[model samples]
Target: MTKEITVTINGEEHTHEVESRTLLVHFIREIAELTGTHIGCDTSSCGACTILIDGKSAKSCTILAVQVNGKNVTTVEGLATTEGVHPIQEGFKENHGLHCGFCTSGMMMRCVELLENNPNPTEEEIRWGISGNLCRCTGYNNIVKAVQYAGAKLRGDELPSTEPVFVE
Candidate 1:
């Protein structure tokens, strides 16, 4: 069976007729044409399909489009505004939090929620927070630093140096 659902994504309302089993991630990518949300694992184990639903982080692959009917969704594409890039995005770029970039979007979405909840998360806390999202590259150390950088920026603290640290 198909249902007509309207979901506001990035402040834009999208109405579409979708199948009962259509995943929210598919709706975002296929219907909304937001390709930033990747489909790494359909089972939701990879957290690659993560997105913000009503300002909360959720695995898009695990949610049905109908489940988010009349809800607001935020994909990675919505993170940046005309003013500048979101701190999380800048953190990733400055800290080299991503390598292949397959999981960058989802990682950023998760970080958005993490920073919202705890703007000054410790390194350990950031590690624990992003445990759900898996990134094959970057070895997670830089990812943690990226979160730290974003947290500092969000909290209006002194911004960390964006210089890339070289390792022997």
Candidate 2:
């Protein structure tokens, strides 16, 4: 059996009929065609399928599409606008936080929530906050720097002059 659900995705409202077992990640990717939210580990261990559900970071793979009915979901594609890229995205680029890029979207989405709640997080806190998201490359040093860069930007402070050391 299928159930109807209406979810606002990236500010656009979408109504669809989905199977009760349909994962929210699949709904966002397959039905909404917002492919930025990846499905790395369907069991939610990898955190690659993270998305903002009603202003909170959630592992989309662990949620059913019906579970998000009438909720607002934000994918990585929603983070930017006509003005420019989001600060977190800019941080990733400026700090060289991404490689291979499979986990970039989830990292950014998770960091968005982290920075929102704690605009000035310590390096250790940043690491702990994003402990769920796994990146095979970059060694997480640059990723941590990227989050720090974003926190500085969000706090209206002078941007860091030093660039993060890139790891192969």
Root-mean-square deviation per candidate: 1.1, 1.8
Expressed as tens digits, the lDDT of each residue in 9-71 for candidate 1 is 999999999999999999999999999999998898889999999999999999999999999
- Each candidate's number of clashing pairs is 0, 0
Off by over 4 Å in 2: 165-168
The local distance difference test score of each candidate is 0.94, 0.94
Candidate 2 weakest ten by summed lDDT:
158-167
The 10 consecutive residues of candidate 1 with the worst lDDT sum are 158-167
lDDT (tens digit, per residue) of candidate 2 on 1-168:
899999999999999999999999999999999999999978888889999999999999999999999999999999999999999999999988999999999999999999999999999999999999999998898899899999999999998854545469
Candidate 1 displacement at residue 79 in angstroms: 0.3
* TM-score of candidate 1 on Cα atoms, chains taken together: 0.96
